[model samples]
Target: MDGLGNYLAPDHRRCDDYFSAAEAAALQGEWEAAEAQFNHFLAGMQHHFAKEETVLFPAFEQSTHLTGGPTEVMRMEHAQMRGLFQDMQQALASRDANAYAGAAETLLILMQQHNLKEEQMLYRMCDQMLVRESAELIARMNAIAQ
Candidate 1:
């Protein structure tokens, strides 16, 4: 059976792929293609965030009996990313490559740091502390509506 990290880490990569594709399209000034790819990336990110926020984080908090630790930090970071998402969306709507690049660069940095924390620390801790509940928690995450 896969642990939390094993199950969730692949999603980060999947989302990254869409993000890269969107960036490539935008760089080429292919607004149609960029819009489609950006939408895919946005949906992927929103879905991933939903899985963590709704399922994994809640379970981790319940198990650890602490609400003001890693999960809180992750939530705050998620909000920051959401704001950047809006900026990117607006840039896309305007076909403003400069704005898009600026927002994407910021988002990319935040995502890298955020993913590192989740992959290196939070997921590992979840795998250990919630080992017995890993399957159930993953199942719940999977069931979340995109």
Candidate 2:
């Protein structure tokens, strides 16, 4: 079942919306608005990562007896992407458009690739190997953990 992945897709879409807006804002030279949008993107993506890392991924690992599975790669990517996001935030805060633009480009690429990987690979694998576990993971991830 793709239950968990389906549930999480909204989180990815929300991130997409923010980043897309950031890109548009940057193009229009709306620096402060772009920065604000990027900040919103950062917080949302971080929350999305937390739901996966702390709940969905761990639960899938537990249910399927898989350690250092696909989630490991995702977690690593999250850290790297987050580092870039932090750099972007700092540059934006300092009103350094040159730095912010470069970082923003990097973030766009990272989010696109990361979201693709999760939706196409990791989540699909989880759906196959942890079908029964999806419901349980979803409940815990969206509820008690919140």
Candidate 3:
């Protein structure tokens, strides 16, 4: 009912939870569990990115006609996170705890910053500017598989 922030903020938390679980497992040298948890985290993150890039950003751009604004910044940040994801994936494949930990630390910082921006600014803008379309927009986001 609150719109974009209501929908996406919880998703950020869900993905962070998976990320934390994966990191904890890796730190404990639980490779099998770490892999499973990391896979979940990765999939969740990819889905979130897809929804924003495909659905939310486009809608926001069309409504606001602000193509070169916060959404653009968020897109770039997404690319950075994807690169980190690749690093984490490679470390996970090798079961390298040290490498994974290093990547995870960077990723955690990136994600926290990114989520704060979305929750505090971008999502609020979407909620206000796209009020009429909020329900359908949120429904579309929800339909994305985690």
**Highest TM-score model number:** 1
lDDT of 3 at 48: 91
Model 2 agreement with the true structure over 59-108: per-residue lDDT tens digits: 77787787887777888898998899888877767777678778878877
- State which candidate, 2 or 3, has the greater TM-score: 3
Please state every model's RMSD to the true fold in angstroms: 0.9, 2.2, 1.1
lDDT of each: 0.93, 0.80, 0.92
Q: List the residue pairs that clash in candidate 2.
A: none
Ranking by TM-score: 1, 3, 2
Model 2 TM: 0.87
Candidate ordering by lDDT (highest first): 1, 3, 2
Can you write out model 1's per-residue Cα lDDT over 8-110, one digit (the tens) per residue? 9999999889888888888789988989998999998999999999999999999999899999999999999999999999999999999999999999999
List where candidate 3 sits over 4 angstroms from the true fold: none
User: Which residue pairs in model 1 clash with each other?
Assistant: none
Off by over 4 Å in 1: none
Model 3: residue 108 alpha-carbon error in angstroms: 0.7
What TM-score would each prediction reach against the true structure? 0.97, 0.87, 0.95
Report the C-alpha lDDT of model 3 over 2-106, residue by residue, as the tens digit: 778887788898898899999999989898999999999989899999889988999999999999999999999999999999999899889899999999999
